[model samples]
Target: MTQFTPDLASRFARIALGHVERRYPFKLDQVLLGPDDRRSPTELHPVFHGSFDWHSCVHGYWLLARIGRRFPDLPEAAEITALFDRKLTPELVAGERAYLDRPLSGGFERPYGWAWLLKLAAELEQRMAPAERAWAEALAPLAQAFADRFRAYLPKATYPVRAGVHSNTAFALRLALDYAEAVKDQDLAALFRHKALAWYGADADCQAWEPGGDDFLSPALIEAALMARALPAGAFVPWLDRFLPRLAAQEPGALFAPATVSDRTDGKIAHLDGVNLSRAWCLREVAAALPVGDARRGVLGKAAETHLAASLPHVASDYMGEHWLASFAALALETA
Candidate 1:
């Protein structure tokens, strides 16, 4: 399994810091109202206005926070600290909160960015540094706002989004659960458990018809990972058997192979690299959750390595991929 080393940490940190505030080449997720609402990305999303889009920028910060915590002596640590100190302020957080108040803002980044914000807060909380803690404190309101969104939305989310894209519910719920567990939020954790069971408990025989052109997530694998976290080991094994019945044979060929990216410069096509990285992490997580002697464990582990090898080198291949891919790469390597 690939590990996150100081050199890799510096590489990812530099990528994140380089774009967190770049402010250009951005795609804003907003509901414009007249000319006044047609504003620049920074004007609309004060804190998350870089890395091509809101969710990317949000996770970019998450990557920096996570890497800085793990490798405190890295050269990028000081800059990461300074960046958080400057950006994660009460005023900026308030500004970010206010944006959610706008019309049609409920769907802005929806569960994806919302999940990353909570993940960022959880990372800072885990680090337990006074300065980092202060940054997390300042970002608490924003995190709470997202948590409230999840609480309000999940009850009404009658169907789970199985897309291999940003709207995927399993991916968001998994990240949110991490934050909930880290903060010891019993209410939030209960909500996640309820929703996970409600959404996926009856699921079986995943087709794994995935790797959509622009997909950066494996809907099948993400759901499996969520079940791994949400269910007890004994229950999870049965669930996994029902959901991926042929995993022992690796019958779903898509699950074991790495996705190919035809164009790294094309934003949508570039997502294949992310797909590989995220699939790597999800596969590794699923493997870890299985019984030690399970035959599927070895298959999943090898598939993870294959996927990691396919995408790890392309993380910084182009500006389009570089702006966001490092974070997913870090996720894959660190989780392994």
Candidate 2:
């Protein structure tokens, strides 16, 4: 199986630190109410104005925190720490919080960015050095803002978003659950579990017609992984049985195969590489959640290996992919 080595961690850290503050080549997730709102990314976002977009930058910070905790002697640790100290200030966080309060910014990054901010906060909370803890404290209000968004939006969401992209409800919930469990937020955790069951509890026989050419996440597998996290072992096993009855047979052949990336230069096409890495992670999580003697364990395990092999090499090959793919690669190799 692929492992996260110190070398790999250093490499990914360098990639994130290289572009976390690059202002150009950015896609702002904001609404321009007037000429006054035409400010640059750094001025508007204050802290997260890099890695192409808001959510990716948030998770890029998450990758840095995760790797920094695991490999403290990393070459980029000082730089990462310095960046956090400079950027993750109370003033900057207040600016970010204010952005969320804007009338037109209600849907800004919504569940996707919201989830990543909480995940970053969770990482910082778990691995609290004196300096890092200060940064984490500074970021709490922004994290709470997103948490409030989740509490407000989920109940009103009549139908879950089943897309294989950033808007996917399962993907957001999985990450949010990680944050909730990390912080011992029982109310948030219970809310996520309830909503997940309501949205996907009855889902079965997923056709797995996915990889929409510009896709990243595996809708069926991510939902399965989320259910695996939310449900107990006994309940999960039965749920998995009903949801993916043909896993042993690999009926959804697409799930086993790696997506083909014809162009890495194009942003949307580059998403296929993300598909492979994310699918690898979801499959690994699902396989690990299964009973030891389950027949589908071997199937999911092999498919996870296949997908990892397909995308691990291309994580830092191009700017288009490099700006964000390392985070997904890290997620694929991360242990639960």
Candidate 3:
């Protein structure tokens, strides 16, 4: 077992807060500057590439929640959650009927409604004090709102799954499970727990598409393992134990690789490996959650180190001014 030094944790906190400040806009209530800021007309487009457009914002907000929990003294906590409520409240109230058709919405056409929201809320809840819960009363309501939406989607005829990085869904569900368990809402927690177990068992085929060759993809896998472990009886343990070693082995190359490009096909030749620091944090979370004496625990340690080493440069970057990668590295470093 390892604990990240205070200096490392502070660096992560700085980066996380930096990302939130630099990327987020109160007016838009979303992270990142629209393409309009750039001089070139052609440059005016979404900044990331993925199935869901809002994942960056979602990921950012979730990261912020963790930061908020880790450093409750900062006023950014209320500011962050307020921004989250601005963008997310409608969807929660919209229930299952909410569709991604809105040009601005980033989620894919799936039943992700409640699962992800609960995760965000849970992260926020972690930092709450007994006296502060009253001030944060909306947190529980917001979580319930997601539950209503998720339950609405549960009866669907068919659910489409992501082809790569199944961790997207897994983290969302894991967060939901975490939220449920922490909140002592047993029934709500069980719902997500059951669904996570079912998906993990059926997701063998999806694992093939994992960005195992990429460091960024490892975080998603960590999240998947986390959600799987969220179930009782060590449900996700065996497979998670099996998954880390190979991913950890790839760390040396992936870390040395240039930054991960935002758009793989843009032809601009950007490096983006640093953008995936969240994977390290997720890996640590999974490792911490696993039952002790499991063989995979050792592998988790190796994977955790690889992830931290990969993120070292960004954590040390004095000029980047706190981006997503910074906070993620901080959290992962803290967990490590």
Candidate 4:
């Protein structure tokens, strides 16, 4: 199985470094209230202005931070430190917070970007290295902004977004749970767990209608992963047994197959590559929650290896996937 080796860490860090601040070829998710709202990515987002979109840029920082933590001696650590010191400042983070306060901005990046921002904050808060600690301090208000959004939004989310794209709620919630767990925010954790259970509880016999043409996530697996993260072993195991009743047989096999990306240069089609990678991440997470003697563990583990093989090599092949795929690769490898 592919591992989070220093060589892979260096490569992932290099890919993130290449584009965290590349301001062009950008896609803005802004609510233009007036003429003055028309602005460049850098102007609108002081810290996150690259990697194609705000959410991608956020996770790009997360990829660098996570790799830097795991491989502290990496040559890229200096550049990562320099970048965080220069950009992740109180003033810049406040600009990001200001964006959230704008009129009609309630949906700006919504749950997806909101969740990624918290995950980045969680990575920074895990250690007390001077740079990491300072970055964490600089970013606290913005992270709070997102966490507050979650607290406010979940009450009215009535239904979860089950799409396999950025709108997917399960993916966002699972990422947010990591932040909640890291910070020991029991209230936050309780809120997220309640929301997840309310949305997914009693779900059984997943049909696994998945691999949506432009999907970057496996809807079925992400739901399973979120439930695994939210519930206890005694509760989750039985729930999962009913959810994927034929897991031992690999039924609903759309999930076991890696998505095929015929055109990596097309931004939407490139999402299929992300599907392979993010699936690897989710598969491992679900497998980890299973009992050691379960046959599904080996099955899920092998599917994860196949999915990683399918996309890990293509992470840096094109600017489309190049802008963001390495982050997913890091998630999969680090989890593995």
The weakest ten consecutive residues by lDDT in model 3 span 41-50
* Shift of residue 182 alpha carbon in model 1, Å: 1.5
Q: Find the 10 residues in a row with the least total lDDT in model 1.
A: 124-133
| lDDT by residue (tens digit), candidate 3, 24-44 | 221121323466433321122
TM-score of each: 0.98, 0.98, 0.61, 0.98
> Cα deviation of 148 in candidate 2 (Å)?
0.4
Candidate 2 local lDDT, 293-336, one digit each (tens): 98888888889889989988999878889889999999889943
Candidate 1 on 1-336: residue-level lDDT in tens?
688889989988988899889888888777778788887777777788888888889899999988888899999888988898889999888999999999888887888999998998888788676766888888899999999999999999999999999999999999999899988998999999899999999999989998898999999999999999988658999999899999989868998889999999998999999999999999998999988899989999999999999999998899899999998888878877
Q: Model 3, residue 166: what's the lDDT?
A: 27
- Between prediction 2 and prediction 3, the one with superior TM-score is 2
Residue 336 error for model 4, in Å? Answer: 1.3
Report lDDT (Cα) of residue 57, candidate 3: 36
Flag clash pairs in model 4: none
Per-residue alpha-carbon lDDT of model 4 for 1-336, expressed as tens digits?
A: 789899989998999999999988899988787899999888889999999889999999999999888898999999998999999999999999998899999888888899999999999998786756889999989988899999999998999999999899999999999999887899999999999999999899999988989999999999999999999668999999888999989889898999999999999999999999999999999999898898999999999999999999999989999999998888888777
Candidate 3 structure lDDT: 0.48
lDDT of candidate 2 at residue 255, scale 0 to 100? 89
Off by over 4 Å in 2: none
Off by over 4 Å in 4: none
